[model samples]
Target: MLPRIFVVVLDGLTAMHPSPRIDRLYLAGTLVATSLLTACAVGPDFTRPTPPTATRYSPESRPDHAAPTMAGDAPSQTLRIGDRISAQWWEQFRSPDLDRLVRRSFQANPTIDAAVASLRQARYNTTAQEGFFFPTIQASYAPSRTKLSGNTGGNSPGIQGNGSVISTVSNTPASQGGTAPFNEAVIYNWHSATLTVGYVPDVFGANRRLVESLQAQSEFQGYQLEAAYLTLASNVVAAAIQEASTRDQIRTVQALIDSSERALKVLREQFRLGYAMRIDVAAQELALAQAQQSLPPLEKQLEQTRDLIRVLAGTTPDQDLNEHFTMASLTLPAELPLSLPSELVSQRPDILSAEAQLHAASAQVGVAIAARIPQFSINSTLGGNASEFSQMFWPSGKLFSLTGNVAQTLFDGGTLKARQRAAEEGLNQAQAMYRSTVLTAFQNVADTLHAIHADAHTHAAAERAVTAARVSFELTEQQYRLGYVSYLTLLTAEQNYQQARLSLIQAQASRLGDSVALFQALGGGWWNRGREQRAEAAPK
Candidate 1:
């Protein structure tokens, strides 16, 4: 059993011996018994707030409320309107480097690690709050040697009675230049040890209210972790896709430059043979220079994008990841995940985290309101003291005391009220922020959807342009061979065809990038059971 001590000190108050009031407080009939009885807590409970009714910016013209179903074995053979994105969505691209980079980011990203640490800290705080519900114990010990002068104040019974007086000094001697009395000296030694235990019982549940706030904060931290995970994955995927697009553009431009240089070479030979005018040769040379100029900028962009992918994949600044990262091998997805407006509320981690913040603010408001109530505390002590250490446990020397204190703030200049008002305003601010986040998420999804649709048409048009330019160039070549048209005419057709090809590649890349953006807007396929299981199996 734990030891307890309760010492109540009332300043400048004297006690009369064996009084009825003292007897009622110490040896009381029922007050002492009731004080030791168990107690329960009382406070407001927690309930989740209701979310907004409509999940979309606008209403759907037609409704299909049934859950999505799968039919065919292969995804491409049966593309449905509501098929969820695969957990390993990037795997569909068939890029091994992308797969490895995403997994490394999940394990080694500093931002994700910071979020995880914050969650663990919140969990520890919750554990600490839980410890308050149990009892507490403490032990103390003090030993000292003392000397007393027999003829000093110790000799006066009225001022030095055993139960009536408490003194800080051990004794005073009357021997040195004594005014009225003889002197004598005595010495004594004493030792003592004590143990104490106490608990607040959470009788009014103020402690529980504080703990509830902490738990809500912990849940908020969990939402932070989820949001961080999504952000890291999205960044890595976007960078990789952008790099792939850059690589494609670089190849397209290089081909155009080669064709332009060949035309310029042929035109120079014609000028030397006196068959082509100087003006025509000059035009070919200018075209070649323009095409050559475009290559360096595109190559630089491709290099920068590749380096960005390397950084997102958790590589050092000086590390060369270009050898391990190649864009030519990636396969672009033909389609993206279909998302319903209603699912956005739960699917987007950042929005969910904002909602959690709102909930925490609401709880803090309750805590602020609870602060206006009265406070109560109980303390106690049980021990014995005697002149002889061996007799300290005797019935006559046994001692115990119980104390209860209650306080209420009568006047604080309305500080508490101002704090309550501040908390209420904070809750309102959080609500507005949550609503804003929801709207932003909706807008993001709508924009991505529009781009993907538009880029598809653009890509098709560019493909047609390339085909027509190629046909035109082939016919012009035949004309040049038959001496019906000049070589300059043939070069013009070839140049148009080359430009068309580069434009087609750019359109293709844009379409693929917009597809990835759409999936990211809908919170598609970053974290799921498959990735979680894979991470668990990985070496720590």
Candidate 2:
């Protein structure tokens, strides 16, 4: 039926020709056959790179639980292997402020906005490329006045009188040429209307491959958007944790300064009563000054961390954030979800995005191969041209053309072949990059796991050290007052207590921060939120 329709159209275009009808039918059938030949794509089909075959992320077995510290109320965390991570993973911390801040960042962050815009752009471009699969039809109408010179060979547009041809013409000036037959110019109005149809039959699947490449690129952008969401959320959580940690450090240093000030006062009174040496008072004063000196940096760090939280929440530094973070305000998740090694390949956005890029590269190889083959095109114009608009569609004024073309690069100095080779190399490059992304992803998980494990032990040790140091410092302080120990011993005990207190605070924060890292390295559980939901969250 399609071939018959093509024959009919061809017959209408070439009606003035004395060509046989069978000849037109044969040509149409040949074009139909050519279109049918493009059943397969030219290059290798894409296959997802296999997931990692390893059973675990680390070489050695990980602990079932993190070591809990006795000094703080923070609980030990248990690792739940092959557990499903929630899409709202941050909620595991049970901090409403953190949850609200992360949500706000998702809505207002510029990075997320940029990624959304890129995804939309890619989708639009892919849709545009798909238009090539259909024939392009356009219609136009033109009306114009044209004049032809009489010098060209043609019959004069005048009445023939007697045996001699006589024509009426404008009077010739006597000065220019005494008496000469006047050359008349012909003027007429031409009207034309045409409907042109053009199509490039993808005889080698070039357009199909092109469309496939664009679709893969769009897919890549979608994953990039997911990556952006993951990164922004992770940043917000980490910044919040850092803010909490810095605040705790500041509080600890302030406590140390207060304790030292109290000690300095006691020493001054002892010296005034002639019960203590001036050097002892001077040493206590120096210790107090040192403790006081540490406060400013901690204060500065706290302020900077607050500013970072503000920015991460997509607000100016001058703008105050209503939500403030402190260690007491955050609850470390007791249960940590760990995905299997095989699941990680599909979980991480970077790995998935790399896979999409590889897919696009594979499609590009097909496109390049298709380009080396002969290209086919069919164009037809169904229109009429006449001197008057009323007669434009008359049979005598009908004008039409049907053309089928095949083009091959005969002598391009191997440009086509070189392009094909380049595409193949590009595919290889994508493969390498994909593998690199997978390796990096695995390394991230392994490193985070190790850090979490180490942080727990460090936290427990720091807590014990703080307890021992506090007891020693208190005992030494009383001994110094009772004339049982030197002021240097008291000072040494005080310094040890101060350092231990600070280390305990750091260890607590590390335990929390590394937990965040573990969640992030495990891909933030984005897959729990299906693609459609995530895409809908993007800005329109």
Candidate 3:
């Protein structure tokens, strides 16, 4: 056995004494007993909080129907309940650019790096504190030149010859000297080398509770790291999708501006020839300006979004992160996992993190309770002291001491009891927070589930609108070419097609984003990846 460090305080004993051999045996026995007793800690042990009793995420579950859209690349998605999520969930999108960007972000995001560092630091602290379970050993050497005390308290040290071990003048205080220890008759140099050992027995489990709290904190950091990973990946995906949608919108708006320009040219000619009114020509100009105005802002947003993606991937805004993404390139997975409500409790990082806080708080309560009880400690110093440095380790200079201590607070201003109560309250707060986190997680999943269901129908309607608008615009344009339709009728057709096309892109993007949100709400499958995988998931 790796020397178990747990020690138990024997209660109700004011003092005890034993020989060194017996002391060793007693300590060994106590260590073994305490190790067994500590199988139960002072406070309530942490049980993984039970998942909500509800069976479904939402009040009314809808079937995920496959509805085809304008783009063939985005396949219809279906919900797969109680299915496992892969560690590399982003790969389901099947976009090389998204895959590469997410991979890079895992390596480069500053928030992820910071969280990783914090987790490492917490692990170190917990590991370092394990030593507290064992006795503390320290070695010391102190050599000092000091005047001899009168002797024992009142007796003289006694006279000595020139070569005596006491010293040449190891006698009493001078006949006319000052009183007591301050009036030393001789001075000598003593070199002492001692090894000391000390331990505070954990009779009430205070030390164990402390270690438990630290362990919970470390676990909390681990979940926090997971949360950072989920947030960064989702953000990168959202920004990429938004950028692609805006690019498509810009193209559509530019085409509208071109159409407006053609109408304006025809109107100007007609106005000069006394066929079209100046008011009609002015309206065409205004329409063209409005279309032109839409392009710059979309262009600006796209550029800023691309820069944001680079930053998320841990690159400077100017760095060439070569990944280029578009809606067409992203493949919507046919099947998406919808975890059971119970599973989400284990999966979500924030909820798990809150649970960890609750664990820590519970342990703190135990520690507080232990503090109000009696404490026991033991220490020993074994070494040699000599008047001459060279004789420090000699038999004549040998010295040793052992001490055992017990302390109990008979009376106080109720401070310790108050702290114990405060710790209990903290536990309650943590419990409440954990519940709230779980509720919010369920809400997120419900919202995303609804969005995904509603988006399929919405995308279906948009596809039909685009198809109808396309047919109408083409016929109207041909009629205008043949001088059978007025400019206003052509303008309306153009606007209808543009509006339908843009709405389809928005719906398509919304569906994709909703998929991302569902993954996020379900904890992003961090458990599928081990700690090492998560810590290094980003681009190397």
Candidate 4:
């Protein structure tokens, strides 16, 4: 019987043990493999949202297909400044001042700094999430001395007399493996040291999914930073253009003032010669005063625009931008590039960010669903122990153990199911938001295009009106001097002429501003220098 028992024990040492926990892990792994490779994901996977049905603005019309062309003749579709706008669109204005200011803004703007910080934060987060893929190992040591009760056999051995021993009690002594009676206390001393290693692999790929989700988030932020950069570029360019427009208007008004003063002098001479009424001179004087009043406001506006650019460029507003950079004249591009709405989606960083967010939401659904599956952890502890401190490393004193645990939330009262549903809802919401953003972007581009075109026409008509008014004013002054017109009539013509000139100046500025708005709406000119910087700084 003893030989058979020994043989059985030896056989057990060579045989494998069946573990239900390991079987479950294998089964879950199989499920994950099949799902990732073959099964369609349950939640929405991101697809780029479509833009508008019409590529161009509804009210805006292209030039006639058969318009005559010449080598030096400009295209009607093109802006006056150039044929195609570069990624650094502001440079097309050919202003060194603008280039320098934009560069300074890119470097010093607080918003840009914040965006860079956020990008760094996302990189750190990615690194932290990656650590989950690796295992953890640790070491520990413990030493202890234990004192047994005095009734045990450590101090004094039990004594028995041949006749005094109870008959019921066995006379034989207890062996090492058997229960025994002893008279003295027993004591024990031991030391333990261990190195433990453990890991819970991504058996269901839940951890991998989580990392994917984080990567998507990181990408989303990257796109957001791009969007911010684009916005900042647009702001600086627009501000510079605005400042130029205001200064030009101030100059135009001053010219108007000079013309009005000349007319006023003629009116005063006529009044002194009894050919014009005192009221005529007084009215002309008032017109001149009003024109003079206009200059201060335009000058104020110009200064304000300069200050805005300075702030955006991360410089003191008191700094002289004009001294460092000349305002580039507002020159229209010769031909505006019309991008198909479908392609426009790729151009806007905000839209790309939205798409990335949708992807993250999709991955989150997988993460939530994975929680319902079993988790497997492999654990081991190798240790040394000894009865005496000095002999702690002896073979007989060494001890070790290996352990494994598989945990699954068998029942969670529908909590996991709800989480998955929430993730699905989130994905749907993101998709909806992405679609909405695209539609809105299309609307902006279209509206801005129409406005720019319409303003151009308006400004042209205003120019003609101002010219006609000036001619009428000159003729009326002659008539008044020759006593062919009344003072009141001259006053009426003078007022009309001044108002028309003022209107022309305002219309010019408005048209220039519309050009800026159109470029902003198109999200143009943000890629070149910004892309260069990105390339230079990108991680190796």
Candidate 5:
């Protein structure tokens, strides 16, 4: 294919000359010779590795649907195998604030910008490498003035006293009383214009293999960019979930503190009336202090989480976001998409990127093999030279030359063979890395599946505990007011309710977070990113 293009280019260059027939025949012969030389490439071609044949990600049997929990109307998630995930999978949470934050991060994040720049750089480098397939044509003009010394042996038309031709050469210096030659120190302008064309035929396909390697590198960078997008979106979702969980925790602690303060006021009134001991008031005071102590850490955590979200959205810490998340605001998706093991290799960007690296390494081996063989090149120049610029293009001053060269290294101390071995080793390394990435991806899915299953049951149990604790605390408080139960028993019931509430909140948040991880591990639906979205993301 490349040879046909080269032939057309050579034909075009020949067309610029006056003798169309002879020039066409000359270029045709040259093209035939070079095309025969580039017939075969020297090394291994790359093939994609086979996908794993396993049907499921985990060794142990897992339930398709997680146990139903009391959080958010008892929403239970079922694994829908072979379902198509949306490109914007984060929207499954049904939070408009989260959707806006993710979209904004895609536009503003520095990591994403860097990845896009890298992809463009790789594409440009590949284009530069492809230019080697054609010949290099250059046009140059040089005009200069030069003078010749008198002592050199030369002759010119000159007048002599005895009608003999005079010589323009002298052995004696002009300062030594000798007559200066007529042409001595004479200056003249020399003008030359040349069009040179050079081509190194891909005799062993070295240039072809080099171009193939660069193309594979560009493909690798493209996958890297996709991976960056997937990572950023996942991070934003997880961070928002964290913020909601912390806020809930802080709110729970504050409610507990207020209840404790009211109980302490009743104990002080009883002690002033001599109906309660001083120890009872001190114990209530300690419980109130403990509840207050928990609030500061939760507040600190909320502030730090807010800062992280700001940075993820590509803004400074002082720049606050208009959107905020709460447990009530985010919905738990009821259906989660699950991909088969066979499709994982094709879906994951890290795996694809690794495969591209292996391809480049394979092409490098071809380049090294070609290096051990002979290289061929042809150069031609058509131009004219004259003493005056006006006559530079005249037929009398025409110049033409065609040269062909062949080069082969006699010996290089086995350097070429060593490089070939190194390239093969690199191929081996990339293959191993690809396998490792596949294993890690499978592990991620398996772990998230296990977490989703366990989190549902944990949240359900916490809900039951909170219900019992709330009933027990209410009964104990009424009994203490009626003088039928001690103050210590009421305090213990309240403490149990506080712990149960916090546990329920954490369990609920885990379910949401693990759902996001499952989507990320399944490749985040990057392949489904449609043409419209791509066009929107492209540089204007």
Candidate 6:
């Protein structure tokens, strides 16, 4: 958007008119820029890569087809190709607690604040560098009382006829430079006022390259900020799912303990009749203890998960959060948007960040090469100096000067060439890093797609296990009550049912967790965000 480096150079040429020396500088730049847009930049110019030729993410196009799942549990998720990813991807889960958690995290999170600050800093630096395109103009006033004597120079001011002789004598050296000399040290006021201007035009585009580099860095931080947001939102969703799974585990274990206790009572009644062995009662009691033993850790995990959510949303563990999540509270989206491989490079924050760094490195090579060439500058000072304050601006006592400067490195044991080579190496490194980041991004999306498909199948299996265990437990309960099954057999069925139920809860959570991961992997749809989602801004 700010490709005005050459435009600013033209601005210096047009406004306020250039001197003969300045005209040459402008003419040189205009001639070079007119030949080619990249004439000013010495080293290799940066070109954004074209999208990959492949139309699909996978060879078999894994996500182009719908995933398979069991009928009763989670349904198959169909990839909705060419569907625009929603900026509010998390809201697809339809959990208000999650929505609130993500909202609060964007506002109150310290990580977000730091990223914003970095973005702002980069913005200011870019702005400051842009200003270098214009001349630096300044004004100054200096008043002094100085002693004029035969030692330093000539006569003191106002020493002759009514300021007339003093003015004439000051402008002319006293006849042969020896006629008049100060007999004694006398103080006189010397007033001077200056209006000056200076400009260092971007003739070779070194400064402009610097500005380009800074703009890329600013964009880099913007992507980084987006990455922070994506990460925080994903973490909150994952933590919420974990909490729900932990709660289900605790609930299931409690139910299991209750079942074991009831079975133990029935066995005790049988023991009095000598129909049940003491070992049978002991087995039931041990089952009860084992189920109870599972409770504390699951409870601990639930509490810890809640605490994690609180911290993610920028609240202390002690702070009360009224919202609680359950498997029922969240809804899995039936359709997921899959970004094509060609578009993924632009959409992914990490990929874009790496690309921005690469752009900056490309600019750096220009800057280093320009440093080896001759640099030009123009300076002018228009001012006046007089013994009287009122006369400082008058034409009779005015002073003015103008100068053009050129600097070129003669030799530094090849230091400038070495730096240019080093910059080229750095560009190479950034290119490699950018390629790595893109590969990683593709892997992330592919892995998430596979996980979603696998999770649905896993949940399906778990659902079947849960159903079978539940039916077996019911049959065993009836048989034990009728003295058809031993207490130990009933306890075994009960434990199996409990484990199955726990697995089902975890599998259900996995489906939800996988959905969050998919949304993150698809770049969190940050491109649609038109403004900051919260009231936070970078500190000035």
| Candidate maximizing lDDT | 5
lDDT of 6 by residue, 268-289 (tens): 9989999989997887788788
Give the per-residue lDDT of model 1 (tens digit) for 384-458: 555457645455444555566656788899998898889889988988998898889888877775665566667
Ranking by lDDT: 5, 2, 6, 3, 4, 1
**Residue-level error in angstroms, candidate 5, position 224:** 1.1
How do the residues 99-156 of candidate 4 rate in per-residue lDDT, one tens digit apiece?
A: 7877788899999988888888887897898887665668888877766564433242
**lDDT tens digits, residue span 400-487, model 3:** 6667787999789999999999999999999999999999999898888778877867887888899899999999989999999997
Cα misplacement distance, residue 471 of candidate 3 (Å): 0.6
Candidate 6 global lDDT: 0.79
TM-score of structure candidate 1: 0.77
Give the TM-score of each candidate: 0.77, 0.86, 0.85, 0.71, 0.86, 0.84
Q: Against the correct fold, how does model 6 do in TM-score?
A: 0.84
Question: What residue runs in model 1 are displaced by over 4 Å at the alpha carbon?
Answer: 1-82, 142-192, 201-204, 271-282, 322-328, 382-400, 477-488, 525-527, 530-540
**Relative to the unseen true structure, what is the Cα RMSD of model 1?**
7.0
Question: What stretches of model 4 exceed 4 Å from their correct place?
Answer: 1-56, 59-85, 139-194, 254-296, 322-328, 383-399, 469-501, 525-540
The CA lDDT of each predicted structure is 0.65, 0.81, 0.78, 0.65, 0.82, 0.79
Position 314, candidate 6: lDDT: 85
What is the full ranking by TM-score, best candidate first? 5, 2, 3, 6, 1, 4
Q: Write the per-residue lDDT of candidate 2 for residues 140-161, one digit (tens) a residue.
A: 9999886666554264423221
RMSD of 4: 9.9
